[model samples]
Target: MNDFSMLPPAGQNFWFIPMEEVALFRRFLKGKRVVVTNGCFDLFHVGHLTLLNEAKKLGDFLWVGINGDQSVRELKGDNRPFFPAWERAAIVGSLKGIDAVTIFTEKRATRFLSLVKPAVYVKGADYTSQSLDQEEKEVLNSCQALIKFIPLYPDRSTSSTVERIRKGSLMAEQNK
Candidate 1:
């Protein structure tokens, strides 16, 4: 039960944590509500920050699930994930509203729901309570987590960010 060596280094964030560590994570959530949200997070952007801030408001702690590199490749294709998995994870882990991060390799976050059993399941408003995709529907049906659809911010998304980055039109790239 004691594994100081495996603990994240001082100030170093952990993102791709294992499912076996859920118990330890739950210990941190004891008596406190937990919120969960899942995404590829291929590129960190304003949309992501908005969603995370909203998710944090729904619970005392927020846990974000990032799709693994292979999962992103399968979902987005070969030239996707503009950044590698570790880098993406580190970026997500460092976000202010995100208390913890983990990787989910499955196409759906169903298996993850069974493991985390968070009190709140946060999602983008693009999906409706009735129109949830099959896997998401399953989680809503069996999991104790309540589904919350946060409003999506218009004109701010990873796709748009990636395009901006590619055209050399983004001012942030100039500073980089």
Candidate 2:
């Protein structure tokens, strides 16, 4: 078993934990309310920050389950996840509200969610309880985890950021 307790403090090496070691890590969070959220978090924008910060407020510790590179590609196509899983995990881990980060290689977070069994599971306002995958719903139900949705930032997103970058590159090329 991995000794996550021997690991560095939350900001140091706490993010980017291996999935197999997560159960061990859970031992340290016994008395704390663990909140979990999952996403690709490709470009890391204000909206993502907002969601994470709000998620933290609902519990004592926040665990972010980031989609692995392959999973992101499967869900968002080959060109998605402009930043790889490790890079994305590092970035999210550096943020203030995040406590730990784990990369999961699945289109849905059912497995990770089951393992973490967080007290609260958060999603973007774009997803309603009814819209969630049946498997995800079942996992949450089985674990008795509360499902919450944080409001999304209206004008900020990785997709929009990518579009802006593309347009800027095109404009620059035109001017040259």
Candidate 3:
């Protein structure tokens, strides 16, 4: 729908959108059923895939929001966001089910959610409807969006992966 070129195709059908184009994208999606989920997505994994795939099933299109690099560092610490925001968005966008991707600087997805106003909003089962950010909840309520939670995959996480790599390196050094 956009006349200008967006970030190159991350996947067969997905679009890596520039922030300036979010309004245009949202307008383009006006009548369609949209699903949304946001996160760091700093490291890709099956857990992410499952969530995105499941989210897509709930609606006609899936729009993913990735935490900006500074936002991730603030929430996940200074050494966080192993991948830059653009790359993370591109990688997440490249996945099989994601239709669109955007990067937001806020630590919470409230602003992004408000802007997109998806028909369904999905999150990992790790969070409860009660435990969600109060402001975010208010925004969702105001927009009348359905909230769905995908069950968390027990063994899949960026933190766990990082630790595993560190432990493997230590063992290799010991063997040497």
Candidate 4:
């Protein structure tokens, strides 16, 4: 049997592994199919969960790469990522489907994807093969990782959630 003693206890197996330590986790995943997905996951919603579950179905191990706080700010603007990277990572790591979570500092998952070299790379349906980041696309191609797209939950997104919060706040202020 594989040595799972180093891993978190059952039901809390999802670990926030540092990039440098990813290789150690890989060793434990030997003989298992690995699936990787990346996103900001700022507000943790059903859409994100759905995608994650779908990705997990494609492989035995599910590794999620989360955008670090600075990366989120660069890609999503200053007001975005209301939740800090550590909190977001913790929330995602707590989910059932994820086996491991890594917070990456890059705006895209190119380097992370290269390092993990997962058997499959999953993305939301919103992104098409042509729309993928050039660097990410190149890395995935070089690694020969299969690209899979899972359908997103309609009308459920962090952006929409933020907008709702803003509108609610504005209305509350107006009433006061």
Cα-based TM-score, every candidate = 0.80, 0.89, 0.90, 0.89
Candidate 3 lDDT, tens digit per residue, 1-176?
22223554433367767667787789988789999999999778888888888898999889999888889999889999898887787778777788898888888988888888888999999889998889988988898999999998889988888889899999999999
Task: Single out the weakest 10-residue window by summed lDDT for candidate 3.
Answer: 1-10
Residue-level lDDT of model 2, residues 8-37, one tens digit each, is 465464556689998888888898999999
Number of clashing pairs, model 4?
Answer: 0
lDDT (Cα, tens digit) per residue for candidate 4, span 3-43: 23444565365777788888777778888889999999998
Misplaced by over 4 Å in model 1 are 1-10, 13-16, 165-176
Q: Output the TM-score of candidate 3.
A: 0.90
Number of clashes recorded per candidate = 0, 0, 0, 0
Each prediction's RMSD to truth: 5.1, 3.9, 3.4, 4.9
Q: Which candidate tops TM-score? A: 3
Residue 69 shift from truth in candidate 4, angstroms? 0.6
The candidates, ranked best first by TM-score, are 3, 4, 2, 1
For model 4, the run of ten residues with the poorest summed lDDT: 1-10
Error of 4 at 167 (Å): 1.4
lDDT on C-alpha atoms for all candidate structures: 0.76, 0.87, 0.85, 0.86
CA deviation > 4 Å runs, candidate 3: 1-12
